[model samples]
Target: MAPLSKDPATLATQGKKAMDESKYDEALTLYTAAIDIRPNSPLFYLQRSICHQRLQKGQEAVDDAEIALYLAEKLGKRDLKAQAQLRRGIGYFFLHRLGDALQCLKWSKKLDEKEKSLNLWFPKVEVGLSKLEEGDERANATVPELPDVSDKIAAEKPSTPAPVSNASPAASTAVKQATGVTTPVDKIREEMIQNNTHVTWTLYVKGVPKDKASVIMEPRSFHISFPLANGSEYSIDKDPLFAEIDVDNSRSSVLSTKIELHMKKKVEGKKWLAMEAKEEDVKAEQASAPVNKPAAAPSYPTSSRTGPKNWDTIVTDVNDDEEEGDPVNSLFKTIFKNADDDTKRAMMKSYVESQGTALSTNWEEVGKKKMEVTPPEGMEAKPYEM
Candidate 1:
């Protein structure tokens, strides 16, 4: 019989299947074949890395995860990139690299909140930090006591539930008094602030069109805000954005804390340069007397529109690719430039798929015990020394 034929996508899918079956070595072989066929496709590397993690090869898992993240970002797959960051964070966590793990998780969290699945894992980080802090405190012969709030709330409330009033005079007056001042629109900022308590700090993106800009949050419940329209506001939950973190007691150690805003002014600057070059080209064409061609219709790439309208949701189907124009390419551009209502849905979907795949794959096997390299040790000499 002829040798079996295998393609990259096939290999990748096979690897994924094997991983699901917990046949990690078989999965690694398939993933390796997939990567050999298509080295730049981050999915293959990410899957292989997952297998490495499962085998307890923390450093190798980190290495592949880093490659996956860099490639994903370069390919404009923000979601996959964020997933890679998360994988890296997990690897770091296993290796006892708390600061690095915190940074990766924080950044990945900033890219998308749904990616905040890592939030539950953060309690582990906190536990590790607590242990370390306790050890340090023990070494120093001092430790702070935990705070309590239960008794204060008990003292404030009498031992009875307040009676519900159906239109009593005092209740009506109270409702009337409150109704005049607090519309839902007026309460948006207040509500956001109240719900955002884990937000130890924020960075405001400045000097961009309010409607055309976006904020990327990191590591769960953290936010980076910017002014939107009117007195109204918009914030990017760190939940979904990729970030790097270095958490310390001082606020100064925060990641991207100074707020490096990549303003639209930068785009305008590029436009200015392009116009200058275009003017020179126009002059050269004029001198060549082919100016009769009416300048070839200005040659700008037409922007394509084929995506959903929501910011927090993304919808995808294979059928979506059949429409005219390159949706993926356009969507990719929109993410780097600015995440608009038109592009936000596709962006979210892209991230969801990319990250979803990365997380579900067998990454932990890379660091698992079965795959570990044990060094050769000398056997007992059968009492010859005696």
Candidate 2:
């Protein structure tokens, strides 16, 4: 085995590279090691949460994302906080919790509307919520209840009824046609066990004649039926399997009283949560699905239309003054340069709003007009002297 690194930063760097290469399991291991070395690092938790999401571990991803969000808030890292919210929302989406998912995604959008991945996820969540609401409304519609029929039905029927047969002629005929067995079949009990390389089904059936029992297996499902001596049928209707199997390699054996079915797994080491996957869940998985490889981080616009219409021009003028080696302008430029993009945009917006006139992008003309109208409070008069 290769040596493990003691430094958390090194481990995290390696983890990111592994994720970029589509090696999610490897990335998860490396991120776990990094977390072990430095438990308080929100970035490590955030990265690991992404790995869990890709692996379809919805609960684990939600837990990790929550931790990352908490740590980011403690450290005052807004960018990381926004990303954590997005991850948490995605986890909820996978779990089919549409309301919770929508809340988180909307919060994340408020924090960073230009996030490209969020742009992709938001619409899907919206559609899911709409569908869920429609379903609820349909279910709530009232249905007419049946009228009382007990008295009329009792008066029409005879007091002494004839003995009922366990198997109706139609049922027996259908069973014979399907399984080539004349015996009556009832409900057969079954249990499924899935492992790394196979799926085994154990069926409890009593007193089935060897010649009468029939078992059929398919890639995604199985069927077994036989007649019991008690005049009842024991059989499994065509039932869906947890996952696809290799039908050619699957076979069944009759023990003294039970039937054992052995099926080779088509995909080794995959964990299945349900006996049958739901159609909606399958479609949701295909929509906004996690990729095997990490996508490049999206670039956000530094300014938006919601900010000052002339924000870009004002910033350029300030930059120009700083380049001319003016001490006051240089000091102002340094302050603005050190601030985050959101803060800078807010500042520009405030200045433009204070002007009380239509905004203009032509900074040279606007700057001259602004200087004449009234110099900004913090700016020195010398800088604006004509």
Candidate 3:
């Protein structure tokens, strides 16, 4: 496809066409471009708000809707404000904010009684509120699914070349051989590690000021950019991570010499075939993934008759006579099965890095310090000889 026209008006029109065709990602980019050029235009934000809603980005949808509402209010355009309120209410609904959603929808109705979308949203909010009152915490109505982008992904390939065939990672090293992903500059090197329950990517850079760096880790992608010593900026915005990650748990740490990103995998033990999921990969993922909408995970109820439940120990039954194929291995397996995600991560990291000389499950302590090989009292650690 040809590039979008530079004019803001043309971009907005193109965005509208794309939005109508359900090409939300394209529409979002176009609308963002238009908004950049025409900062004062409420219409652009309103259109972008719809795109965000269809993408199921509730916060972004709410933000854009508020921007449109604010601009409309200033101009006293009751009709635009009504539409904005309707979108705002839907955005709040997607965020599972029942009270806020109801208020916004009511305002939208007061502004324009004939608004068509209100008919669908009003009852959704009511149902959600009723469910909340009835002791159902996860009671929000179904929001729009994220835009299906397999076709778009297939069409737009990365500028940089990657291996046509996916390579298997080394279990011990967690990195694929001869598969280092380099950045725009030859000096920067990046590696992706598929750890036991998460993925960690490290970027080798130097002399980066803490305040000048910006790193964003999202569910499907990540973006990194920072100022270099030579007055130039280094950036790499990778879209579509090899697999989905848990955004809330995924985090980044910046050190003096390197930056590390720890991304909790959405599905445990799912190997990443590549650093980025190309066309074929996305299709396979969609095919194998669940067809139903998102469902909440079941929580273990506590017998805490008072304040918060204690995490120091959970009373779980384990049969003492259970078969032990490998006594040591069975013990580790038993401990791992009952451990949480963080504890599992800590155990893996410490055991692997310490050369099996130490094992620790305290995530807080393990995270802040580097692990070292502490051999048995009589044994000494040494480099492996070929």
Candidate 4:
């Protein structure tokens, strides 16, 4: 038959299948051909590195992993880079560079502590280092014997799900089909926190295996299922998300502490006020949301001993005097300009509220009580009786 199809996606899928069957050598050959056809794919390089790691070729593994990490960094793919660093650390372990291997593995954990593979190697590396520190010269620290199906134990992730979009990076995680109706049972505890561009649901399920869990990502909903430690299955199903999400960018991870499910917000900068939407979600959200408006200019600074003064009214009074050419008004304006902040405040409060019957400079007494019109001895102050 003619050589395997030239399509990189087909070759990648084939390589994954071979690795699943423990045919790592054949997987390596297929991935190499895939890399030749599309040399820029960090995903392909990373997969090839996995092949070398399984075949126990230390240098070749590191070589491919280095290329994968370099390309991953260029692509700004933290997830892919974490996997690359993890495999590179394994390569260093096979080469007997325990110190370098430990460093790479720790860095990989820092990149993504939830990568899962770090859990397996951390204890093994620590034990080996402890023996070396104790001066055990003959203690060659190698991983446990590789078994036919033990790849499940060491693999960074489960076999690639054959999602329809073979060329997309999301093909790495095919949306799993729900086995049955999945609902959160009383046995599990779940918490969700919404962020601006992303939302995360945290599940605290004890003794959850990485391979035992499954996730289904969709634009408006998601479902996740896993077998619990107590010989029962647990699941969380949200059919209607509070808002739409980018299904392609959504992902999940499991850790010893909790299981984290992340979904990217479909509308950038849109806040999901709640985890589930309702008929009145929009109205309630708008009512509770803070109004973000441009700030108003601050009032003119004043050392008024009483309280805030109507500086706008004072300015308008000055303008009126200029237009009318009132001698009394001009004289009062001169007095106002010469007064201190407190004196000016008392003049405005007493003059305005007293209806021009008084203009006081005593700020200390004016602030003690509200100003009231005190008509001359012969006059009586009356509201709306002017």
What number of clashing residue pairs does each candidate have, in the order they appear? 46, 4, 0, 0
Candidates ranked by lDDT, best first? 3, 4, 2, 1
What is candidate 2's local distance difference test score?
A: 0.59
Off by over 4 Å in 3: 134-386
- In model 4, which runs have C-alpha deviations exceeding 4 angstroms? 133-386
Q: Which one wins by lDDT: 3 or 4?
A: 3
Q: Please, what are the lDDT tens digits per residue for candidate 2 over residues 249-339?
A: 7777866557888889877897767666565644444443443422322222222334324556666675565354333234335555655
- Evaluation by TM-score, superior candidate among 3 and 4: 4
Alpha-carbon lDDT, every model? 0.45, 0.59, 0.64, 0.63
Residue 342 lDDT in candidate 3: 65
Best by lDDT: 3
lDDT of 4 by residue, 1-386 (tens): 23775555567768878988888889987887766655556677788988887777888888778777766665566776788888877787777677667878877898987564565465445544554655553244333211132232133332334336555555432322122213334556788887678899888765555544545566776655555433454545674577778867877777755778888988878877667777477345445545443233232232233445565566457545543333324445655665566666666666665666665666777656555554532223454311
Show where candidate 1 strays beyond 4 Å: 1-5, 133-386
lDDT of 1 at 292: 23
Candidate 1 structure lDDT: 0.45
TM-score of each model, in listed order: 0.35, 0.36, 0.36, 0.37
Native-to-model Cα distance after best TM-score fit, residue 65 in candidate 3, in Å: 0.2
Worst 10 residues of 1 by lDDT: 377-386
Q: Write the per-residue lDDT of candidate 1 for residues 1-386, one digit (tens) a residue.
A: 22222455456656777888878888887776655544555556678888988777888787778777765665666777778878887777667676667777777787766654574455445444544654443223111111132342233232234467789899877754443222233333321111111222334322323222222222211333323334333333332111122222113111211233221221121122111124354334335432122122211111112322232332233224334333223423333234234333433333333332221112233112111111111111111110
